[model samples]
Target: MLEAVGLSARESAVYQALLTRPGADAARIAGDCGLAEAEVGAVLLRLVQDGLVVQSGRPTRYEATAPDVALGKLIGRQEQRLSAARLEMQRLTQMFRDAGAPGDAGQVEVVSGASAVSARVNRVYEAAHRQVRAFDRPPYMQRLGENLPLQQRRQREGVAFRTIYSRDALALPGRFQQDIELSCASGEQARVRPSLPTKLIMADESMAVVPMAMGEAFAETAYVIRSSALLAALSALFEHEWSRGVPLVAGPRRSSEQLDQPDEKTRALLGLLAGGLTDEAIARALGWSARTTQRRIAALHKELGVSTRFQAGAAARDRGWL
Candidate 1:
């Protein structure tokens, strides 16, 4: 444990020996700690520098400081060094900010690695005041583990939070449904679209983060965009998609009877339909033939007492089916 306070193995052993034999010299400490006299001399010097041992008298007697007092002083010194480093970091950051052109459109930052990207994301939400708009999908580097609490806390702080998810995002592994549901329950407005290109997280309309590449290269790299026309354009795109997204937990699932009538498959189909998925896309998702999917859609419409697909959607919504 003394090693944690900057003592080497020999130094800690020597200190322990000194505690047991307070006025022990190097020869005596070496005997007790199983070290050679030369080794004991070097270890004692280091322990003295670390404030764990004190030397006194002409014979250079070594004494151990009380553990509590010595460790406390060591911790205080370590904390002071840490504080100084933090101040230096802040100073360097400010200098960099001052050196940069204000509001530079070309001020795009490339963030690489999963952990780095995740940290940048957490920072964005931590500082968000007005609102957070996000486009969520798969190829995720990290789960929304840290985001859950921050969203809930921000919601309580009255910072508007909304997330738009792709239908496929819900199907990806790793507690996707539970994560989204928990956020929605915590007052985050969540919606689902059938598809979304890339991923985006925009906070307060001033900054945004988006993948530098899309589709197959989604998780490879991302960009942090500052206040610029590109940021505005991304925000506009989010709003456009938000206007088209279906609330993941909007209104209700279905009337009690209507809910009991549909199995998981039917419910999933309804959700995809409500998300505005094309039949071809739905067929691809469900691994059904086009004809089979059409039949199912017709049957679904018939079950809802609706004639056209649009009416089916309306009737479904009216019955709390979507």
Candidate 2:
């Protein structure tokens, strides 16, 4: 047990003997452990440093501390030292790990290239199974890279990341700037940026990495980071950058106005639909043939990008264009 915590063989022997009989004088302790008195005293001093025993009395009598107290103290000291040692080791490990390729070591994998990188990012998006905590900087969001539009639409689907972006990414004009504005008008989260780049990806802070090489004509390299130390460092960097970002302007959206101010016929069609007008009833009421009414409803659905007329009505209602 003593050896387990790094005690010398002699130290273990002397310490064990002291425990078997706590009040044993140094001479008796030495004899009991088959050691010379001077040797016993030396080992006892070592044990003291090891927190296993202490010297008491003016004559320098050594007494063994209670096993519970001694063991607890020893283990606690060892654990503290081990924890500090591990932290230093982890820091060094991160340095080495970061220097190496971030290819999947078992379950973990690192991918590169804009398309491949977007695929990797989309894993987080599709898997959002919940919310998207977005921190989309303009340049990155607008990076006319491959598959940008599809990715942005998918990003806007959920509540989390859109707000972070709509509040921030919309301020700068470039790519998806209008989308950001549209989102902000929808009364979702969208903020403006004082400054930031087209880089950053983090989902639940469990994973986060930025492209070390961005906006280059060719190859894109992601500085994939996973270690808690590194992840924490990156998160801190994001938060610091986020703090400097501008707050989003809360105001009415122009899209709502555009959607509301349709032509009179479009408005009449929408109003009829809003009043629960079916195709047959709308056709009869508007004195239009059934085919024409269905065509108009179909066109309205196409225009609104809704699967159902109710959804169109709901969207119209949401935009206050009803």
Candidate 3:
């Protein structure tokens, strides 16, 4: 319990033993705390130097200082250190302002360690007011679950959240469907795509956290990008993928006419494409000339406002026409 105050487990045990028995010798503390006599001696020396235990009497007896007194001094020292750090931060901020280039462009930070990454994620979420766009998948920090309440609170406060999940992520060994449904119920727009380029979380289009390494196993190391052209490129990638994702939650209500009305032939064309059929095979199945089939396929692409067959299938699925 006192480890935060610079006490090791053995030191805490010896201190507690001394507190319980006012004038215990090293051997007595060792037996009581289940420590070796030599270890107890070393712990007692450290405690004495830390001012939590004092040496007294003939053979160097040990007694613990009152908890209130010892902890008060430790707290004072910590506050002094914090004050010094705050002053140093102010100095650095001013120096950067004087010497740094204008705007936040090209500013990037590589944050390592799981705890540090979690802290940065929380920091970004707290600073976001307008929108938070996220690409989420597996190999997540175990502590990521703790942020749900914060997300819900932000949703209540009118902050927009849009999340895209990989198809595999939703199929993991958990009650993910129920959890996702709950999230959607609370105003988060969600979508699913077969795969994603990377794990990303962008705040208000100004800042983003992306993996420094390629795969899920390297989730701990991340790059925090500030406003830069690179950030814009990341935003563009997200938008492109988002356009090709199937909505898991219902989007804004649209009139029936607003949804593209592709007829049965158009549906059949897309279904054949989605099934990996060749153009010739599709034409043979439909009993149409290859030229006519190609023209219809081109027309279908134009109707869906997508150039690629994959995007066409994704758009069809997103609009519930397939």
Q: Report RMSD (Å) for each prediction in the order shown.
A: 7.3, 17.6, 13.2
lDDT of 3 by residue, 33-87 (tens): 9889998999899888989999989998988999999878987887888899999
**If candidate 1 were superposed on the true structure by all CA atoms, what would the RMSD be?**
7.3
Clashing pairs in 1: none
Residue-level error in angstroms, candidate 2, position 163:
6.3
Question: What is the per-residue lDDT of model 2 for residues 63-88, given as tens digits with 9 covering 90 to 100?
Answer: 67777887787778789999999999
Candidates' TM-scores?
Answer: 0.61, 0.35, 0.47
**What does the lDDT read for residue 183 in candidate 2?**
45
Question: Which residue pairs collide, candidate 3?
Answer: none
Please give me the total number of clashing residue pairs in predicted model 3. 0
Question: Which 10-residue span in candidate 1 carries the lowest summed lDDT?
Answer: 93-102
Which of 2 and 3 is the better model by TM-score?
A: 3
TM value for model 2: 0.35
Off by over 4 Å in 1: 49-51, 86-103, 106-132, 139-161, 182-188, 211-214, 218-225, 250-322
lDDT of 1 by residue, 20-77 (tens): 9999899998988777999889989988888889999989998999989988998888
